[model samples]
Target: MNNQFKDWKSNLDRFFGHDFWGDFEGMMKPSIPYINMYQYDNEVLCYVSIPGMNHPKDIEVFVDHATLTLKGKIEINHRGGHQIKAEIADGTFERTIDLPFPVRSDKIDATYKNGLLIVQLHRYISDHTRQNPVQIRHLEDE
Candidate 1:
């Protein structure tokens, strides 16, 4: 009985602390730029803080109901310009997160402007119980 309870508790912890909240607290506690979440009536929005991206359009956004990944490459010339300070990281970066609820990718929208990336996952009809389903392209063996 105790082992069963432990198993359930562990699962609950992961779902809430990691899966549901996307490990926000753990990731944000470090010396790194972070992503923020916003709640709306119809959607859940995410704001990724990515400063100094030479080509903002190069960013890639991937969303699985279980997680979201943002991948991009930035080239920063440390010595190319004079009188510079320091940066946490340079070159490519990848950030991932697990959302509180399953993302509604069908109704999702994403845009990158300024130095930040914004993603909107429609929540009006999102069903957390549903996993991403597989649909075959061709119906027959060819």
Candidate 2:
């Protein structure tokens, strides 16, 4: 593969696969929410789409260094006295990721609006600390 055409490889990929069901609802339905990532000088922003959710507190966000997991629930209305029709994944949702640098977990922040959850994690500065041996004086026995 040439260096110039490497980026174009993904654009030419024409998927010719089959699913359990027909193409009517298999390839056209959007069930799970989509997520986007953005990097900044001292923080990283994650945008997750979860439309029709009423409260942001229902969602969960977990982070440890390079890994981040997001779990959330969404409620829906159905016929026959308001049932459930979940398209935004009302159960456990997870997304594990690797960050370029360490993040400051204590300073991480999150906000949700318009059914989109936006998470911001501050970056931590890596400071190489060294360890050295120290001499101690022994106490005399009683």
Candidate 3:
């Protein structure tokens, strides 16, 4: 009986552990910006569409080898003109993504062009995980 109970517990843990549901939710949620991620020979590139954000000071990027986080706020200045349609999203938003592979936290770059934010992360060559936290860097930090 003891062995059978242990086996059942292990099976349950295997089926419902870690972040399986959270990962599914992240992919299904529409509130987060859609990301296009691709892996290259030595780096990974992620692109996100964020229109109307004209300044670098409003964005923050962080990576922890296996995960990437983006948080920022979009502020739109509206003139006194009344009676207009507004469809753009404003206010603070955050999105977390699970990276496909371990990335070197020390060698991450981000750039904003037109209405897209491009992030490049170099693949970690060694098995060592970074001891420090990934810095939250804005576009101007480069």
Candidate 4:
């Protein structure tokens, strides 16, 4: 009976252990600096939440045809005391967002105020009907 009880306790520990839950918790959480985006007829706007940053210039913003990337670091001043609880995220982070349409790279603007980064982008209009003619070659010409 003692051996059976020990086996049951071990099985319970294996099922509800700290190691298993720790990994699961890490996997469930998303990355830091959560962002919200809005789309307009000719523009796209994004609002990014990143607090505790020293300066606005610390963040880097990159814009491609249809993607926007943000890179930055968040640092917390501990004041030389041992940390008891840490809910705010620190360290370097990069997040890429997909835009609804291709944006004009030269017409992008960004501003940081009150722990929020606002980005404004203009949509790029391309001529879809314009096509480049491809030259076809015969196999014997190789």
Name the candidate that leads on lDDT. 4
**What is the Cα-based TM-score of model 1?**
0.55
- Error in Å for residue 98 of model 4: 1.0
Count backbone overlaps in model 3.
0
> 42-137, model 3: which lDDT tens digit per residue?
789999877768787678898997898999876677768884785665667898998888888899889998878999998787746546678787
- The runs of at least 3 residues in candidate 2 whose Cα sits more than 4 Å from the true structure, single-residue gaps closed, are 1-31, 80-92, 129-142
Q: Best to worst by TM-score, what's the order?
A: 4, 3, 2, 1
Q: Show model 3 residue runs off by greater than 4 Å.
A: 1-29, 80-87, 127-142
Candidate 2 per-residue lDDT, tens place, 18-115, comes to 33234544577554557788999878988888776778877778899877777666555445675455334454455566776778888888898887
Q: Report the lDDT tens digits of candidate 1 across residue range 1-142.
A: 9999678767877767755334544575453336898876656889987777767567888888747888886555555657566544455778788776666667778877776778888653436644688987886766
Highest-scoring model, TM-score? 4
TM-score of each: 0.55, 0.57, 0.60, 0.70
State each model's CA lDDT, in order.
Answer: 0.70, 0.69, 0.80, 0.86
lDDT (tens digit, per residue) of candidate 4 on 59-116: 9999989999999987776678788997887788998989999899889889989899
Worst ten in a row by lDDT for model 3: 25-34
Which residue pairs show backbone clashes in model 4?
none
lDDT (C-alpha) at residue 137 in model 1:
83
Q: What overall lDDT, based on C-alpha atoms, would model 3 receive against the true structure?
A: 0.80
- Model 3, position 135, has a per-residue lDDT of 77
